[model samples]
Target: MATDGHGGLIQPRKVPNPVRESQSHRELHRELLFSHSRGILPRHRAELPRVLESRRLRQLREELQGPPSDLEQQLRKCHQRLEEAAAGPDPGPRPEFLLVRDSLRKMKLAEPGAWQT
Candidate 1:
């Protein structure tokens, strides 16, 4: 991560010397930025957008901006998981589930049961 002149953490940048960064470190940085932009150093939030809008993020964004292959794969996995969840049976009963049930009952019987049910 780079820092602004005021010592605030800025968005992660491509290492000025790429040779100094390991592949794992680069991958980790990419994931951190992509997954949770807010989770980055708290101070970075203020500096990030400015840096991103500036030539710095633009240059790096152009070079390393495409969705990482890992993210694409994870997204696919998430879709698959959602599909599975939708297709699968509910795991079990939940009490809060009855809140909506009760609301619908009230709506259906609004005239007589509005206050009773």
Candidate 2:
């Protein structure tokens, strides 16, 4: 650890540090900047497998990628159990299971309907 004359810590470098960032991050950043004309599309990164990131980097990029937290894991387990138990979509036959149509429903409807009409 470098320190100044008054025993204060030295200022960090203004340049990017390899130690502070993973290789994937640097490569992805460059790729995005180089492809700026594409307008920040998610499909652009689909070719680059994001699994290469380290746990710390992944944590830092939680919005993009990371292993679920304890609470999320527990919730996922509970959700799985509920799904497995066939407890969903039951009781007097609900209407559409949801009050509103979301992306999933839109995507499903976007395809041809199963009916012969």
- The candidate that achieves the highest TM-score relative to the unseen native structure: 1
Clashes per prediction?
A: 0, 0
lDDT of 2 by residue, 1-117 (tens): 656675885667699777549989878888878778668665655544545445557668886766778999999899999887796655665467464556566767777575337
In candidate 2, position 96 carries an lDDT of 73
The model with the greatest lDDT is 1
Q: Model 2: runs farther than 4 Å from truth?
A: 1-21, 38-40, 43-79, 86-117
Alpha carbon lDDT at 6, candidate 2: 50
Query: What TM-score, computed on C-alpha atoms, does each candidate reach?
Result: 0.29, 0.25
Residue 83 lDDT, candidate 2, scale 0-100: 88
Candidate 1 Cα errors over 4 Å, as ranges = 1-68, 96-117
